[model samples]
Target: MKPLVVVATLCALFTLSQQAPSKDKCMCELTNSEKAFPYDKLGNLEGNAVKCNSDVTSQKARKLQSLMMGLERRLPELAKDIAVLDSENDEQMYAAISLQLINNELWEIQRLMDELNSTTLSYQRLSASATQQLKGMRGKMGELEAYDSMQVVKRQQDNRRLTRDLQECRTGHQHIVQPTRRPRGACPHGKFDNVTGPRVNTAGEYPGSYKYGAWGRDPRPAAGTESWYWRVMLISSNKYGHYVRLYTSLSSLIVGVSTPGNILISPSNPTTNTIQGPNAVMYDGALYYNCYNQDSVCRFNTSTKTVTTVKLPAGTRYNSKSNFCILDECYLYTDLDLATDESGVWVIYTTAQDFGNLVLAKVEDTEPPQLGQPRRTSVYKSSVSNTFMVCGVLYATRYIDRSTEEIFYSFDTSTGEENFNVGVFLHKVSPNIISLNYSPVDQMLHAYCDSIMVSYKVLFS
Candidate 1:
């Protein structure tokens, strides 16, 4: 009766999607997915990782409270199913799923605590609330561990937890994170190697004011704009933006010495096709991003100031249903992550049919935008913090700490090979990186981390 009451409460939070109980073997008896958790593929964030002092603004304290409240709100999503997390004995095959959800929630709680430590204020009340919630959930993590008989369930949740901790043992901030891994693919551009740079750029004009956004070079720059760099910051609740900031060069953008150029996507309605999530990149002469409040990608041309869009395939998750998360926290509305490579424009997303795994599509360079056949992968989107393309290889990163992000997985589109052995660590100048991108022409990665524009260099041989 308790379990039923709890499930009903959670179900009330979402539009009930009632499904008849499986009379056959439970969904738990399903095949052990090769993509199961504790992802053996990914390694930990270890090395002589650089440590930096956190320079977070006080305003972020309020943001932290809001994010924690959101985390509590999302808890119901984990308990909406019929199974109870603590049912003593029942058809509770969903225990493992519930456990994994708990693992993620705990990880996020710990991550938020780390964030609280970095902020200027000691919002003791806020910290206590988060601490109390964390206590309430940690026991569930232990129960999942104690129920080792359910190896399949425990492993799935453990793997997801392990995947998030991909950076737990490391220390750093969000700034410039560059990976220097030799691509396991045909290097049409150059032989890829380890990326390195003077990674720290202080918070942008609005330090900690806007926490989500992206910045990078336009890989396929038009005639006169080869030296330009671009940025798109999600100015509303870290979910939406209507403008793209411009810098004359990487130097100007980094030095904070020049007035950045600007392009408003729309003068009247900021979100007509404006940026929706932080995972956007500037390519050629246009800005590519998730469209406002939709499951689509928007391309805003810099010169014409017009917009072009391509609807993502059906079953795609938008409006934050499928967002990016690391061990610490989840970003909102990052469903359609746009990236660029030596090849062309691309979008990394997830689909319901793919079971929330990653699906990559090439945004074909054409008059009206075209999306290529989506190449699906078993790599779970929830496990990756950010992704980028280089020489047709898709690389995924994970959040490590206050000043670090780690590149832990790679998927080559050309070879259809997934490699999770790339253990590369990057120094972060902020607490979170909402957006990241790679520029082919300059061989650089532009990271929009906690409202600051940071730079890193990744060259191919």
Candidate 2:
């Protein structure tokens, strides 16, 4: 019924036919013993050697017959079971084969045992060769495992070293990154009311703390009893301009000049006949200021009280809208629409913005001398809308630390200097001020705190 069974049956029929004695046996020729000896190489023997070979074949054939008989009985039952597995499902096909394969393997083991008995000496050689080959294979397998383990260890160490080096390099770079240093020093506070260096103190008595503002520039010597050393000035909150009031020693010496009252207030609007204030600088007895809502710088003669206007460019940040201050030869002031960290300082007379930029040009001369843009400098946290110069250094009131107010220190018109920082706070007392201004007569520094101003006289060796 099955192809394997049909083939096996046909092979058995052929084997039986070979064993049968044929009637044509008279036509066959018999070979000698010597010829039969060489027949061993041909795998076929008919004489003495054939007898020996036949004995081995007979024994093998007997064992094979027994094994074939056992397989024949078991294979049929296995086939019936396999048929049941196939009927169950395709997935059970492998299970059926596995179950039947044990019988086939048993049959093969029996056949191998028979062959081994027939060729006992050759079986020994095969076993010895197989054992040697197994030993060689085991040695190669051990070497591979050892090499793999060493490679793993080396890779781990290399990774750790690389990680450590990377971390060290990162730390080193952070340490050396950007270089910054804290600025150190003090501000120079000059002696008030003493006349040794600049102001003449012929009044003999020092005046206490009082509010005195500037009106234009009062550059007059002490004379009559009513004459004052400084003038009181005011910037009107109602209008965008400045005004001046004279505070002579004569007023204080005769009637005792009243402070908070001695200063003048800006006149009410629509008073065109009265003078409006601008930033003023006194040079050779001439006071210069800007008129109300005007771009031209106006000059006032102190001796004759004559007024004249000079046409000038409008300020950048101040379009008749901002306050202004004066340095020696330049007008130092801010502009309109000022930037927080980058406010503009417009120097009108000498034609240069001192703080943030340094644009220097002559106001009257037609020949422009290197008229270029100012260099950039960052401002402190607090806004520095005003500044004053003492000695050669400039002091601007701006924020240094975010928590407190500070005065920034710097010297303009210097060469190759980059250090600028918060110099002093109004609350602190010190032995040294950065740029101290002393009175020409009695030298002392006046430190003001609210209403009480303290005078310190530094006797420097």
Candidate 3:
């Protein structure tokens, strides 16, 4: 019986030792241990394994409770951090967008500023032009009123004379009103003694009549026509009026400054006519001057001493003071104002609308010669110092001083070339230039200044 009991005990110990361990303790080695453990042995140990049952109890319940607590504490803090990051991202995005919008606005403002600047400049130019035009219009209106007054006075005088003449004719039985010939000095304004046409008589065309002084603006006489003529600026009439006296082969130059002097030449009847004073020029036996209205140029015959109208092209007007010039022939060179540039580089000096243009026209002709269309030369936009002509050659100077300005240009009817330039004060040096008979008769230019007359010889090749 004792042996049998010991055998039972040994058998039970072997059975317990043969039981499979729990999967938690042998996870990696379970597959390798599969052959070592028998399925029948695992079934038998299930009911008898008391120590294995206590050790294999589940710990998932404790772990799950701790994990829940940790998740509750950290998840809210993470959510707050995510919210802050989202807000910061949104702010950065907004800042970038705002910066872009500001840049766009600034660009627009700059573009508008450029446009406004351009518009302002244009407006300023337009305003200046309008102001100038307004001033010109006002001046013209005043001139028109003066012209109208003169016309009224002349008409009244004409009516009164006609009425008296008609009454005399009816009362005296003068064959039904035949107008009687009035004697000399009968008309208040000088009578038209004889209205004769232009005469081309060579007998009367010697030592051409007309003397030019400071204002030397006229066509020079042809060579061999060297006769001394006296120029007198009569203060007899209006400020614009003067008389020219011409006497040929006279020993003395009797300028009418003091009194009417004697003439030795077998005097043909000396003629007297009116001219604009101070700015008078003698050209080719005629006295040329700007008319009183300062619009047209009038030519008075030094021999006949008669005034004739010179019709110029439309839109042209001469000045009463400092405007016109003489080229060659009887041709005139007038300065006209056409246009000016943005920088005001070409500011015209004359009161005439178009100044600084070259107007070439004859002055001392009896009848208005059929001069072909006048040629309009250089718009010489800059100011001019002086202009003179010699032997069909035109001369001009831009500046007066020598150190600052240096150039002398001589142009002819055909070819023009700039010949020389020098550094000398042209203004300090006197312009003793005068109208010469063809070439300078004495090969010299004379100008009256500071009391006495200054004369000098100009070298012309």
Candidate 4:
């Protein structure tokens, strides 16, 4: 019986050990809170079958409870990590949006810069085109002014030629129609008594006759009574090319009578100091004349025998080469044509301020000769070859021929009337009359004609 009981206990123990593995597997499935708990750990607990029922189970429960407490403490840290990841994802999304916006702004700025550059280039092209147009207009305006000046010169020449022809035709017609026979010895000696045309007084109240005079010998004045003097400027073959010789008697020159007492004026250095123009006038015991190289008026005091000079205004074009009078206008160089009346000395000059028009000024005859304010006259646009003052009236001469000059214009200072139809002809015996001067005392016109001195006795009506 005892033997049979022993066999039953052994069999019961083997069966309990196999059955314990199933119980441990069931407890691990029921108590394991972690989803990733290892099955090998459960099998190891089953092999230790001595403590599988109480100690192993209690130990596993304590370990699981400790693990649960640890997991609870770590839960806040894990949640913080997840929130940080979400914040990083949101920051990355905002960064991508900001980068795209920046690229769009860069493209807009580049477009504006390109448009500004294009506008600047277009403005430069327009400025270049406008400058070229203005230059072309200025060139065309200069051409028109030159053409108008030429036309005025041509018209003046034609009018002078017509007047000369009419006068010659009338003189020839009178001689052919009515011939007057004169007896021998009817005319006085050294006097022209023959008359042509009607005996009409053509000089008209002036104390001078401008009829054709016969070519006679020069009337030699007596010595020590040479109130009327004539000065001639000639180029000498000596070292001084410019020399001025004062003649006491006009007839003495024609008779080849030269006196050592004649006054001779010359420059210390003729190379620099050159006398200009055939126009010279005597006033208040002084001889007023123009200088050639310098734009200056010179005064020679006859008593003192000293020279005084007055400089003209700056930019005054008073050169020998410049024409005194043009076709339609007289230049400032016309001031070389000096004149004197009962009032004072006068000068006709032009300035750039006056637009190249002639201006007349009266000199005060002071120590330095102060010039008054210039007066603008209507005689600027007239062909005045020479000018003279008679009874305060300025008469201008126009060239008719070598032997004739007509007083075709007059400016009356008293009335301010400028007449262009003054048709009084002055017949000269010698063709080359270089200088003409009228003396109020003698009522004679003193003319210097190419080394020959001549005088005409003026007949007044």
* Alpha-carbon TM-score of each model against the true structure: 0.58, 0.33, 0.35, 0.44
Query: In model 2, which regions exceed 4 Å deviation?
Result: 1-227, 235-243, 250-286, 309-315, 320-382, 399-405, 414-418, 427-461
lDDT of 4 by residue, 320-397 (tens): 333444344333333455666546677665555655555556767787787776565565423565666554556666
Model 3 — which ten-residue stretch has the worst lDDT? 192-201
Per-residue CA lDDT of model 3 for 1-461, tens digit only, reads 99999999999866865686455453233354223334454454443344334433344233333333323433443454344444544336433433443443345345445655665565567557656655765665454445454377668878999999999989887556657753422322221111110111111221222222332212355354454433333232223345543443111222212113221121221213233433445556555554444445556665564666554566554432443232321212223211111111011223344464554433324366222334334534233434444443444444433222222543333343333332212222223222211123323233322112233223321
| Each model's total of backbone clashes | 18, 35, 13, 1
List candidate 3 segments past 4 Å from native. Answer: 1-225, 232-241, 245-273, 277-279, 320-355, 362-366, 370-373, 379-382, 398-407, 416-440, 448-452
lDDT of 2 by residue, 86-193 (tens): 554435543554444445445544664565456555546645765665576566545444545337766887899999999999998788655654232222332111
lDDT (Cα atoms) of all candidates against the true structure? 0.71, 0.35, 0.37, 0.49
Candidate of highest lDDT: 1
Reference-based lDDT, residue 121, model 3: 67
Give the worst 10-residue stretch by lDDT in candidate 4.
Answer: 192-201
Candidate 4 RMSD computed on C-alpha atoms after optimal superposition onto the true structure: 54.3
**Per-residue accuracy of model 1 over 305-333 as CA lDDT, tens digit each:** 88999999989999889888978578788
| Candidate 1 regions with alpha-carbon error over 4 angstroms | 1-184, 255-260, 268-270, 459-461
TM-score between model 3 and native: 0.35
Error of 3 at 322 (Å): 6.3
Between prediction 2 and prediction 3, the one with superior lDDT is: 3
